[model samples]
Target: MDRPLRLIYCVFGLVTFCQASIIPCKDDDTKCLVSTANDIYPKIMSGDASIGAEILDPVWIDEIDGSVTILKYKFERCTVAGYKKCNITSLRIDAHNSKLKLNLMCPEVNLSGFYDINGRLIILPVQGNGNFSIDAYSYNINIDATYKIVKTDDRKEYITIKNFNFDANAEKGAKFQFDNLFNGRKDLADSVLKFANENSKEVLQEFQRPILSITYKIFIKNIYKFLKAMPMDNIFKQIYPKLHSFTCVRASLTPPTPCKADDTNCMMTIGKSVYKQVLTGDKSIGAERLEPMKFDEIDGGLTMLKFKMTDTTISGYEKCDMKDLKHDNAKMSFAMKITCPHLEVVGTYDMDGRLIVLPVQGKGKFSIIMDSYDLSLTVTYKIVKDDGGKEHLSIKTYQAEAEPIKGVKYEFQNLFNGKQDLANSVHKFANENWKEVTLQFQGPIIAATFKKLIKNTNKFLKAMPMDKVFL
Candidate 1:
């Protein structure tokens, strides 16, 4: 019996001894991040496939207030065929029990179009409150226009609006009034002009602006719908593999440029907004800095507005400091910096949902060197297989090895469970067995605290619903 216990202990002890022989290789910060990210990618992707399939991802009409709902969308990375890359990251809605369930797995691309890759769709659980603007715009536009669109929809050849068609009138005075206004009397024109001059602002205000009300009857094509209507030939052939620059405000547009390999011109995205192809100047590998502005408060806190480049992810907002574009063909100047924030809750394929983004390193690198080895317990977590058919997220406990780094022969301690026995296996191995793994970094630490990079990354992932594991 002692032999058996000795043998079992020997097996465990010898393994621990082997672990003590770790010889590390030095690597830079990028390598450190890539290694860590690659190490976790499989788990993240698997979770996306399994857990994301279970959540809800749609919004329905019956859930609206007074048969209507209004929404306001701030624009971000778009410049492709006049579309902005935006993901609906949050919904501030006001209604009675108004819940907008956005399918996070929805096939959407950066203001360009959607593909099946990002996930089936994202379904969101909306909380808090604000009136939706979709209904309000619809209401305002439907009323108060002499040329209000009767059939603004495209199924017909022309936009039929409520026109003031003088041609349709048979009244004798109407024709005389037209002749007087157009050809006959300068005095009559001056009198009418004076009346308009007095009331013009009010008329324009009524036509230009109305009560921002919500209406149910109007159905205008939204940006997403408009993009979806592009012929597949157009989307895949003309749009894909090309890059564009867009301004989130006004009529800023950058035409698509051909994409090349080897440069940062590789596939990159702004938030959930996708764009491809970029011109690499004489230098082929530097990513253009993206300078999209970011807000400190709000869900889905980042926006992207630059075109694609080689190895960098940049965000941009129009330079408040620069002069405006002078002409149509002029190359608009933009200022870019590293940007785009991950969203918390609220899901839709807007700029915030774009997958390939530049990563942030917080303080970049930090360190934690121990003169003695002590395995920490309590604050540990491990990837676990749960009953939801998806992986179970479980707590792991670590016990310090209990020996000083200098004096005694060192040993390794593990925090793992038998049932949730993954032990970082899938990340380290194809099979379920864990491997003798090692890591190297540009320095011993990353970000301000040695643990901060990982901590911030985890915070980003954790803020997202379990279904939305990073893509």
Candidate 2:
């Protein structure tokens, strides 16, 4: 036989025996099903074969007269004829065969004497210890099978095989104990071997149904075990990538509305009520505004969203202040202290944002961040999708500025502690030159603060799906 055929036979034989050791379904069993399917599918597609298991055991074949017990039946190889397809509904195995190396311990069976030339009578006793080989054939095997999710007695759901049945003809070829029993009688030995071969089909047919049934049970049990182990959510995601999108659309359309004549791109609308819940309830985009998120538009694979936000009280960064900052110039060298307790920015801004689906680019911003100085900010940001399909925000460009506000305190400490007059003079000068001071420090400080904010925002966006923001 060719190398590929040899390998196929070897794998088949091993898997046949190994199938007996399948365990019951467990909580995390889907991996085994997926792995087994993956392993089998490629080999089947490539016209190669691999063993799912290997085992050592004795097999017994019972007959009407007596039972033949194989002392050590070594499954040598198994090979199936080329098949086109296999699925949950049915499986077809063309004319397939397997080989076995058998060591038989056959007891002596008494036979009536036969007269030779009407002169001498000879009695025969069948017994033997010799190397034996057997070949099993399964012809035109067809199986009708179905897949189902069944709940076990323990209330756990498991994928299972259902309505399993098969049709096939089984035939066998065996090198019986002819050489040992009928030695020196070539004619008798030949006759005995022929009879065994011809009648072997009957014996094979007798056991074929039970064997196939057991094999199917073993395979099905393994599949059940695998499905039981895997989580349902993961299984759904693997089977249906757009399942979440379908769910989102369904949830949005509880009370369905009519689509407009020109609204071919509109998936669903987020009305005022749902928009409020989505913005306020979401921890990532804690948007607060009187206006609602209007109709979402999709153009050439890009999702555009328009929204307005105003007077948002976002918590977490309650206080940000800088103390003991020394500034040295040609006229003065003194430590400056500036603090803004409960720092926050309240502003009104509108967004015209577009989310590119294919390349996953996000553009446009309303007000990204604010401070107590009523200074609003807008940034160019991108939505990055990781390898695992999770999205995060990254700030590309930010506009930073600082405008002097009255009542803002500035404390200056002179180089010499006793120079109280100099310290007062320095403080007065700093207040008088507030615009220059603010311009000097505003870029670096805002840049640093925005960097930290972007990092935190990215993490928050990653934790929550971007679709939730639109919903």
**Best-matching candidate per TM-score:** 2
lDDT of 1 by residue, 1-471 (tens): 121121211111211111221122222223432333333222211111101110011111212121112211221211121011112222121112221111111122111111111111012111112221111111111112121112224432212123211101111111101113324356744554354334543322321111112111111112112222222221111111211322110012232232222223222222112111111111122322123212222122212211111121212222111111111111111112222122111111111122122111111111112222221111223333435555322222111111122221111112132222432332233111111111111011111111322232233323222232212
Where does model 2 exceed 4 Å of error? 1-130, 136-138, 144-148, 152-156, 162-167, 170-189, 206-218, 229-233, 237-471
lDDT, candidate 2, equals 0.32
- lDDT (CA) per prediction: 0.20, 0.32
- TM-score to native of every candidate shown: 0.15, 0.26
Q: Residue 280 of candidate 2: its Cα lDDT?
A: 32
Q: Cα miss at 324, model 2 (Å)?
A: 54
lDDT of 2 at 376: 28
Query: How displaced is residue 13 in candidate 2, in Å?
Result: 21
Task: Tally clashing residue pairs in candidate 1.
Answer: 74
**Residue-wise C-alpha lDDT for candidate 2, range 436-471, written one tens digit per residue:** 434322332344344444444344444544454322
Residue 36 lDDT (model 1): 30
